[model samples]
Target: MTDRLPLFPLNLVLYPGLVLPLNVFEERYRRLVRDLLALPEGERRFGVVALRSGREVGELAGDPVDAVFPVGCVAEVATIRPHADGRFDVVATGATRFRLLAVDDSGPYLVGEVEAMAEPKGDDAEVMTLAVSRAFAEYQRKLTGAQGRGPVELPELPDDAVVLSYLVAAAMVLDLSDKQSLLVAEDGTVRLRAELSLLRRENALLEHIRALPAVELLRQGTAPN
Candidate 1:
């Protein structure tokens, strides 16, 4: 079934179960925030589509966004802070996945007729979830080290396999195409497999870099080498 919801097109992708902090400075988006907060708690849900190309609203001048993968996760406002400058600092938590059907030009923000995506299912889902979680833990460690930070504290994620898939999807640094593929994946198993593959590739790259002798490599092109 299709339903109408307020759309917020961004330059980033949001995955279900993830928390995204947004700074609402533009007048149009400030209006969007106002309208969303006015609604009842249960009805305060919106879609977050990544802007493929375009400047102003209703202008389709930029490169066309990949229509085949035009779905984004629906998010609910978890916290809202009104600023003195008529802007807002809002934290939204991904709630459900929604597929955009059509864009409506009724409000300051874009509105879309969307259908919620279904959760994944399978038999080996539990094992897949565990594996994905492990991968994320390792990735988090590497990320923290790379950022010159201490070890990261892992969050208490759900035990269910499907939930794990969403968590991994949210954490991985997947490109647009991979992210879109995850959004349209038929089940958690498929998404988990994809994320695992991505993690493995990243791990391989990191390992390759770590194995290289930094000093010697740097000395190769130096004078009198």
Candidate 2:
């Protein structure tokens, strides 16, 4: 399961089973996209790791990944829209996660030596997935109300713990570090439990916002987000 991949370190974390729409406006990334498109469909992919600090390699950071976490998700390009100005708009889906063993800088983009991570599963994962899904349902309802809308019924969730956890985490409004921590978590149960806690906390905040006066809530800062 170990292999080398073209690395693109972003400020945001991408979880498996989620879609990430990227604007490859930079020349380096454009090149990366071009190279990927040149490959066969099965091999049109790259590694997207979150940047823990500083900028990504595209910005020519003093070090390509001085503050980056070693775990990342693999992104398979589903669609590519090329622009006349040499920019690219690509839609990719997260396939699986990997742990970085090391990095190489000999290519135009960062090359990561990585091993596919193991996915944990069991009764604990199933229970945690249910708990997190319940909390997320409440959270979504609260968020809808905060946005001046009626309640929204949460949709049926995935039965698999790994898929459910990643879906809930990706749809929630969380900071970079928190999401990154979830991404770096090796165990599915751990990720699900953490997400349950986060969903509860965020739902509480949303409930508080729902209790505020419309004008007051609007002025409260970021509009209940």
Candidate 3:
């Protein structure tokens, strides 16, 4: 489906099925929250595109087209709390992937002409799903130990390959570009293969280093996935 969506360019990538919490402290984003709140419950959503080369809180020096990645996730508001100070505490869940066709910056916040992306389960999706899950389990174990925490407990994973892929993409402690690659993968099988490679690389690094930088340092100001 093709439609225009309010856009929120962030420093991080959001994957489908992941939960994102935001403190709407910026005036433009506070306005974005108010506008979404006015919509019907099911229709309250916006596009969350990762910034390519600009800060999330301010206007870019160049056009937004040069500042944001082409692919983004649709964030559907799940819960919202408005403060007396006109800020909002909003919890949104990633609903679908979209390709940004063009940008509109006349409004307070960015808006996009976006087309919903097709979600395909490629031929090897089932096999790759199992492989990625095993790799991720080991990766999580190593990551936990590296964090000085003992024994990672794997969460209950969904059987659907697409959901599983996005879940792993969200849960992994990786760089923005790495996660963005996963987000833009053409299908579940492709994403799972990429993730398998990433998980192995991370697991190896963790094994050799035996330590990791604090997650907060890596994730910066973003909410926990």
Candidate 4:
């Protein structure tokens, strides 16, 4: 079913189950937050779409619809603390995925017509989940060591494949486009497979250059270690 939702264009991607904290200082977004707050507890939500190309603050150039990715996650408000100066500190969790169908810019903030998306566990979800868990653990260790953080205590990976997929997608320090790809993946198995490949690639690069960022590693064309 399709529904209308308030839209917030951000520079980052938010996967289902991820927790996002926002400082609402922008006038338009403040209005969005106020509107959401007026709704009942369970009904407060806004769509968070990753900006394709544009600043998160200020005015978006050209068309607002063209500035963001069509795929987005609904942020369900958990807590809202309003400040004396009209600013708000809000904590929300990613609840559901949605596909933006159309944008109405007539409002103070962008409002979108969206259709909710379903997450299916595709073929070989169990097998791929195991593989991804192992790969991600190693990737986490290497990433921590490379950042001069020494050893890391790997968190226990979630057993549910869908949860695992979103956890890795949200936790990994990947580029915006890469993270968005994971968000828009067809199913749990597909997301896990993509993450496994990404982990291997990142792990290889981290082994070669123990301290450089992934962008630098790519630029330098460093071979796998």
Please, what is the TM-score per model?
A: 0.79, 0.87, 0.92, 0.92
lDDT of 3: 0.84
Residue pairs in clash, model 3: none
Candidate 3: segments with Cα more than 4 A from true spot = 216-225
Clashes of 4: 0
- Predicted structure 2: lDDT: 0.77
Model 3 agreement with the true structure over 1-225: per-residue lDDT tens digits: 689999988888988887788888888888988899889999999999998844654756568888889999999999999999987888998899999999999988889999999999887888998898888878777777778985655676777899999888888887788889999999998999999998888888888976677662113254421
**Model 1 Cα lDDT, one tens digit per residue, 133-194:** 78777766665555556565667767777777776665666566676777677788888888
In model 4, residue pairs whose N, Cα or C atoms come closer than 3 Å (at least 3 residues apart or on different chains), thus clashing, are none
List, in order, the clash count of every candidate structure. Answer: 0, 0, 0, 0
**Residue-wise lDDT of candidate 4 within 8-29, one digit each (tens)?**
8888888888778888888888
Q: Which ten residues in a row have the lowest lDDT in candidate 4?
A: 216-225
Candidate order by decreasing TM-score = 3, 4, 2, 1
Pairs of residues clashing in candidate 2: none
Ranking by lDDT: 3, 4, 2, 1
Worst 10 residues of 3 by lDDT: 216-225
Q: Write the per-residue lDDT of candidate 2 for residues 73-145, one digit (tens) a residue.
A: 9999899889899888888888999998888877777888999988776449878877887887787777777
| Model 4 segments more than 4 A misplaced | 213-225
Reference-based lDDT, each prediction: 0.69, 0.77, 0.84, 0.84
